[model samples]
Target: MSGKLARLQQQHDSLQQEHKALQQTKNQLNQELQSIQRTASNAIRISNERNDLRKQVADLTRNVADLRQQNRDLSNESNRDWFLIGAAVVIAGILIGLLLPHLRFQRRRNNWGAL
Candidate 1:
């Protein structure tokens, strides 16, 4: 009877020790899981920020392209305007040159007939 009682007490003590150890392991695992959850949350936030930056970069790229096109169009228009101005100046010079000679000849003829 004494041996059976001792055996039963030993078994109970062993089970208690095992339960304590298992509880410790469970607490450690829960802490590790919480740390992993925090890491995952940070990763998701960084990924969303990265995606937003990419969209901004894409929009800026398109804006730059549009600005470049506008600059080229303005340059072409300026060049055309300068060309037209130059043509107008040349035409005016030719008209002045031809009209001045004709006026001088007519005045000289009218003076000779008076002489």
Candidate 2:
């Protein structure tokens, strides 16, 4: 009877140790699961932010392109205006050179007839 009782007590002690080890393992796994959840959430947030940044960059790029086109158009028109002004000035100078001398009056003087 004494031998049987000691064996049963040994078995109960071993079962208790195994239960404690299993509980510890369970706690560790739960912590790891929580860590994974946090990591996944952060990944999702970062992906969304990256997408938003891409969209903003695309919009800004298009805006810059539009501004460049407008600048080119304005510069071309300004150049054309300056060219016309220069042409008018040159034409006026040419007309003055050709017509100014012809427009001058001739001076006349009375002279006595020679025999």
Candidate 3:
């Protein structure tokens, strides 16, 4: 009877140890589940932010294109204005060259009393 009691006690201890190991495994699995949940939440937030950044980049690209077109238009207008001014200056220079020599000859003749 004593031997039987000893065997029964050993079986009880073994069962208790097994139960404790199972409880520990359950706790570890719970912790892993919580970690996975947090990671999923973070991934969703990051995805939203990435979409927002993409929209911002698209808007900025369109703005840049508009500015580039405006710059080209302004450049063309400036070139046209410069061309007109250059032409006026060349015409005035030619007129002065043709008129100044005649005026100088007349002034010299008047001073010498030859005409």
Candidate 4:
């Protein structure tokens, strides 16, 4: 009877030690799970931020393209205006050159006839 009781006592102590070890392992696993959750949250936030930045970059690129197109259009319009102005000046100069000499000759002829 004494031997059986001692054996049972030893078995009980062993079980107690195993239960304590399991509890420690459970606590450690919980801490690790919390850490993993935090890491996952951070990763998600970073991914969202990266996506936002990409979108902003795309919008900016589109804006730059639009601005470039506008600049080209303005430059073309300016060139066309300058060409029209130059053509007008040239036509006016040519008309003046052709008429001035003819008027002067007519005046001279009229004066001679009167004399």
Candidate 5:
């Protein structure tokens, strides 16, 4: 009877040791899972920030393109204005050159009649 009791006690001690080891393993696995959750959260935040920055960059690029087009349009308008002014000045110079000789001949005739 004593031998039977000793064997039962040994079996109970082994079962207890296995249960303790399983509990330790469960605790380690829980800690690892929590660490993974934190890492996933950080990754999600970084991805969202990257997406927002990309949107901002796209908007800025569009704005720059629009401004460049406006600048080109303004430059074309200025060039057209200068061309018109130059053409008008040339026409006025030609009219004055043609008219001045006729006026000088008329003045010479009027002076000879007075003499």
Candidate 6:
């Protein structure tokens, strides 16, 4: 009976030590899990920020293209207006050149008749 009692005591102590080691391992795993969660959270935030920046860049590129098209339209209209103005000036000059000489000859003929 004494021998059996001593053996049981040794088995109980061994079981207690195994339980302690398992508890320490559980605590370390929990700490690692928390660190992984924080890292995942930071990664998600960075991904969202990167997506927002890409959207902004796309919007800005569209705006620049629109502005360039508007500039081209305005330049074309200005060129057309200058062309019309130049044509009008040339027509007026040609008409004045043709009519002035005719008027001068008529005035000379009238002066000779009066004399």
In each prediction, how many residue pairs overlap at the backbone (N, C-alpha, C within less than 3 A)? Answer: 0, 0, 0, 0, 0, 0
Lowest lDDT 10-mer window, candidate 3? 104-113
> Stretches of candidate 1 above 4 Å error?
105-115
Pairwise TM-score winner, candidates 2 and 4: 4
Which runs of model 4 end up more than 4 angstroms from their true locations? Answer: 105-115
Tens digit of per-residue lDDT, candidate 3, span 1-115: 9999999999999999999999999999999999999999999999999999999999999999999999999999999999999999999999999998888443434555654
| lDDT (10s digit) by residue, model 1, range 45-115 | 99999999999999999999999999999999999999999999999999999899788453445566676
| Per-residue lDDT over 57-106 for candidate 5, one digit per residue giving the tens place of the 0 to 100 score | 99999999999999999999999999999999999999999998888553
lDDT of 1 at 55: 100
- For model 6, the stretches where C-alpha displacement exceeds 4 angstroms are 105-115
Work out how many backbone clashes candidate 6 has.
0
Q: Which stretches of candidate 5 lie over 4 Å from their true place?
A: 105-115
Whichever of 4 and 6 has more lDDT, that candidate is: 4
RMSD of 5: 4.0
- TM, every model: 0.81, 0.78, 0.64, 0.82, 0.78, 0.74
- In candidate 4, what are the lDDT values of residues 47-82, reduced to their tens digit? 999999999999999999999999999999999999
Q: Could you tell me the lDDT of residue 86 within candidate 4?
A: 100
Error at 93, model 4, angstroms: 1.3
lDDT of each: 0.96, 0.97, 0.96, 0.96, 0.96, 0.95
Write the number of the candidate with greater TM-score, choosing between 3 and 4: 4
- Which residue pairs show collisions in model 3? none
